[model samples]
Target: MGSQELEEEELVQMVRDFIESESPSSPSFSSSQGLGTFNQQPNYLTLQEILGSVEDTEDEVHQKILKYLRNKNTAWKTTNLKKWLVMRLRMDGYDASLCRTSWVTTYNCPGGDYEYIDIMMDNDENGGVGRLIIDIDFKSQFELARPTTSYAQLTDTLPCIFVGCETKLNKIISILCTAAKQSLKESGLHVPPWRGTNYMQSKWLSDHCQKVQPIPRISSNNS
Candidate 1:
C-alpha cells in the first residue's frame, strides 16, 4: 500500500474545506412546502452575487461554482486537464470590471481573489499559469490530483491521487476519463478495453454509464 504523506503547508488542506462550503445548500432542495408559509426555501445565489461577498468563502463554494459552470451549458464537456483547471478562473479575472458590469445579467463566472490570481488569457476557455494568491480551492480530504508519477531525472519520487470519495476534482477527472473513453470508443478502440471498477468513490457516474471501466477506487477492496 502506498503511504499517504503529510502535507507541508497546512493551509493546502484547508482550501479544500473552503471550496466545499461554497455550495452547502442545493438550490432546488427545499424543506416541505406545506399550507401557509410552510418551510424554508433553499438559498440559491447568483454567481456574481457570490463573487461580491468573497471576503471569505468555503471550499465547497468553489466546488459548486465549478460544478455549475461545467454542467451549466455543457461548455465543460470538452475541457482538458490544462484548460478546465484553476487556470480558467484566472482567465475570467481579466474582465473584472466587465464582469462586474455584466454581473447583474451575464456574470456567470465564479469570483476569485484576483489580486492573487493573475489573468493572462483573453477568454475564459483559454489556459495558462497563474499565481496562487490564496489556497482557496478544494479541500484536502477532497483534494484533486493525488501525486502519481514524477517526470524529473534527478530524483525518484512517488505520485498519484487517492481514489476515495466524490471530491470535485475527482469528478472532473472522471468527466475527462469519460470523454476520452467516449472518443476512443468512437474510434473503435474501446470495443475490448481493459475493465475498470466503480469501487470506492464518494460520487459516482449516473445510471446511464453501462460499460464503464472499473476504476479500483470505485469497485473492489483490492487497495
Candidate 2:
C-alpha cells in the first residue's frame, strides 16, 4: 500500500473509534437513562422550564444582559458587547468574566475555539462555588442547513441567550445533537463530526478554558 493508502486507513480507524466512544456515554434527561426514553416537550414549556430553573443571581444577570441588549448601540460589535457586559456585571458586583476555549484537531473532530461569558458565584446553601455559562448566540450553534419540522421546533426551544449551569448545558447539548443527527439523516445529508455531542460539550465543558477580564476600551479623545 502507498503512503496515501496508509493515511486513509488511519483516518477510517479514527472515525470508528469516535463512534464507539460516543455510544455508551451519550447523555439523557437523567444520567442513568438514555435518549430512547426521552420525551420532547413543547417549545414554550421547554423554554419556561429552562428559564425558571436558574438561581436568583443567574436570573438577575440574565435580565441585565437582556436590558443591555435592548439599549445597545447598533455600532457595537459582538466582542464589544461582551466586554461591555463583563464590565457592567463587575461594576454591579458580579464575578463575571470573558472565557474562551480552544481544542486541537483530533482524528474524529476538527480544532476550534469559542468565547462566552461566565459568572462565578458562591453557593449560599452549600458554601460551594458555582459557574453559570452565558452564550449570546446559543440557539444558532445547533442550526442546520435544512431541517425537519420536528428538528426545527426542537431548536426553536433553545434560548437565544443560554444562561445555565454545566449540568443543564450538558443535557441540552445531548438532546440537540440527537435531534440534529436525525434531522440530517431524514434530509439525506451526512451528519458532520463537529455536530456531535462531544464536540458541542467541548466548547464549554472543556477543562482547557481560559477566563479573563476584558478591559473596557478607552476613547482616543480622552487623551
Model 2 lDDT at residue 8 = 43
Every candidate's lDDT:
0.25, 0.68
Off by over 4 Å in 1: 1-76, 79-82, 94-223
lDDT of 1: 0.25
Clashes of each: 34, 0
How many clashes does the backbone of model 2 have? 0
TM-score of each predicted structure versus truth: 0.19, 0.72
1-223 in candidate 1: lDDT tens per residue? 1222223123323333333433446321111122132111111122112222322222333343345343434332323221233334433332111010111111322222111111122223446432111212222222212221111100011001111122322333443334334444555554122212122111122222222121222222211
For candidate 1, which ten residues in a row score worst on lDDT? 150-159
Question: Cα deviation of 73 in candidate 1 (Å)?
Answer: 4.6
How well does candidate 1 score on lDDT at residue 221?
24
